[model samples]
Target chain A: MTTLHVIAHSPFGDQRLASCLRLLGADDGLLLCGDATYALKAGSEPLQMLQAANLGPRLFALAEDLQARALDGTQVIAVDYPAFVELSLHYDKVNSWL
Target chain B: MKFAIAVFSPAHAPSSRRALRFAEAVLASGHDIARLFFYQDGVHSASANIVAPQDELDVAAQWRTFITEHSLDAVVCIAAALRRGVLDDTEANRYQRPAVNLPAPWELSGLGQLHEAAQLADRLVCFGGD
Candidate 1:
């Protein structure tokens, strides 16, 4: 089953994003929200890491959080609350890295 | 699809509020919630004694209202609840605690119940931890 890895912590805090990427299945997706959106900050090491992963369209970020943190210029699929509900159902499971 | 939502955040945390909103959206979208498992600090949401400041939102109250409105099956992890001092009458008696902070509609069960819900649900979503 495909898993939607929801990460709400900052990538600088721990290895959650790295570990999620390491275990991510071929079809798995990553959704960044809350402090995790900080990873999208321009020129941040976390952004480089995400860019290197080549996630393409499989990566997502909460639009409200992105706007709150002023995280723009990234190629992430921004999801609203309704879209978040839809994405969770579209996937087989959601594993939150809390 | 059915969802088994596990909350690991405290009542005052942002994640707790987010989880509640997600649960509401899930039902509004025609999805079913198999269980609401409160673990770790999340057990505080089941505490009836919680009182938020007049200006701040009371997430615990909101959660209770939501659960009651839907007549949903909400479970607070026994171990976590005990650790956090959230107790029902049965547990208050069992442990000789001073008060019974957990009330009707919110049941206290073991982690196995969460696992069972996850087994039966199409999705297991968790919120908050640190």
Candidate 2:
């Protein structure tokens, strides 16, 4: 199944995000929201780790969350709530990392 | 539809209660729950030592009774449970603990169980901490 893992916590602070990363299957994807938007900042270690994982087009970040945190310049695609809903429909399962 | 629920918060948290309600609603609507995985602080729901006040609801007991009545596959992550002092009989004995708090219906398992649930279920919704 194509799974979409929604991470709503900060990368450095919460251990669940790391657990989510470790559980990612080959066809699985990730969606960053809430405090997780901080992880999308360019040059951040978490972003590097995501890149190293080779998630490619599967990685996404919520535009509203990033804007709320005043974050910009992310390699990951920035999607709105509607897009988020659409992504959830596209995937068979969604695992929120909180 | 087969649904899998994951709870990331403890029994004291609102998210845990919300997850339970959601699960009940799903089952009432004729859906099947493939598994319920409790990770991180959510493992507290499986512990039997919780004592709520007379007025306030006992979330742990609520989960235990509901899971028992439904014969649900409620799994508490072993790593997360051990780290948070939520132990089953096997874990309590292995760690030399005085008592086992995790209830019988709720099993202590690895993260692989969560992955398996995700793959098997049609949808996997998570209620997590803020």
Candidate 3:
């Protein structure tokens, strides 16, 4: 499954991010950071469509996604600037999955 | 998903770092990044004379290293960079300048590159001011 992390901090909000999310198939995961409420507002409708379609691992807001990952003891797929740094630091560890 | 990021803020500012970090994050997420375009004041981030205080991080160096490490296509709008005195080697010679400050791993190009990036990328993320 592909994971997309969107860092939305521009005045244009998350319109671009939302459009990308809408284009993804059901098995994709979306991780949003910074101005997430803005992403939620921009993506609400498309997210509902994906949910209704029963697409797996759809949009994940910060808190809910983190908490769920913690409860399941699983690493959540995330896209964001800081998250990229973390991944780069540990590329070798995750190379097998990639 | 494939993505592109457009940065429009001056270097050393919070917004600029935020934008760079965001681009780094997008790449880390295991998705493809088509390009990183610097427009308006954001082109200044490619300037080589950007010396930060000892206490502050060297943003220009950071961006250079990041782009080189990732082999990311980093383009600065030629018109904007020239207007702001950020010159490439060719432009510096054209203008008969003594030194060229615009660093490597960042190319100067027209807005057509930006348009091409938008067309190629599934998501074109813009950072900094409107």
Candidate 4:
């Protein structure tokens, strides 16, 4: 089995990353780090509106799906740059696990 | 499944975080990550001076941890990193910079690495916009 790490830092308004996710498949692993959560938050309004209006769950469902996968030991870690720097300093950590 | 992820976002945004989440999800699904190629603004994610606020989340650190834990092959675009002042040790010495800040677990390399990833992985997943 292969894992694809998707590093999203663009605006949620940008659907490119979402499209990539769809292409990878519905059950793929997802990690939300950095400002990507903001994008998700910002988009939540419209997504919720859509869900309430009976349009579709699209984004909401995606989030729920990703959350489920995360709880299942699929690791969806989110941290900021400083934390990343600290982790980067410890190369052994990245080399040993995934 | 073998996959490759291409990141092209600045370090402080939600898009980059989402990308990492996607990578983790991929792993959870029992897939192998071929490589992670950081390009354009994405190189800033590897910068060492990036500090997250005390209350806010630090996504870059998460990436570092993810890469380390998963043994993910992380390659930053040399041109992009250099242009953005993300200097590795060699780059720091080449430019005679006082110190090297671009941290480990991330390598400075060419776009060729991107191509290699695309060819090697079953899927080349790109995050962020053009």
By DockQ, the best candidate is 1
Question: In angstroms, how far off is A93's CA in candidate 1?
Answer: 2.3
lDDT of 4 by residue, B1-130 (tens): 6768788886676557756876887777567889999999899777777899988778888899999998889999999998888898899999998878687898999999999998897666566631
> What's the DockQ of model 2?
0.20
Segments of candidate 1 deviating more than 4 angstroms: none
Best prediction by TM-score? 1
The C-alpha TM-scores of every prediction are: 0.93, 0.61, 0.60, 0.61
Clashing residue pairs for model 3: A5-A79, A80-B25, A81-B21, A81-B25
Supply candidate 3's per-residue lDDT for A33: 40
lDDT of 4 by residue, A20-47 (tens): 4545433333334333334344236523
Residue-level lDDT tens digits of model 1 in A69-88: 88883689998776888899
Candidates in order have lDDT scores of: 0.90, 0.82, 0.64, 0.61
Per-residue CA lDDT of model 3 for B1-130, tens digit only, reads 6777788877776557766766777776677889999999999888888889999988788899999999989999999999899998999999998878886888999999999998897766666531
Docking class of 4: incorrect
Lowest summed lDDT over 10 consecutive residues: which window, candidate 1 chain B?
Answer: B121-130
Q: Which CAPRI category fits model 1?
A: medium
lDDT of 3: 0.64
State candidate 3's TM-score.
Answer: 0.60
Return the clash pairs for model 2, or none.
none
Model 3: docking quality category:
incorrect
lDDT at position A24, candidate 3: 56
Give the winner by lDDT.
Answer: 1
DockQ of each: 0.63, 0.20, 0.11, 0.09
Task: Give lDDT tens digits, candidate 2, residues A1-98.
Answer: 78999877788786766678889998998988767777766788887777788777888987766777888735778886446656765798787765
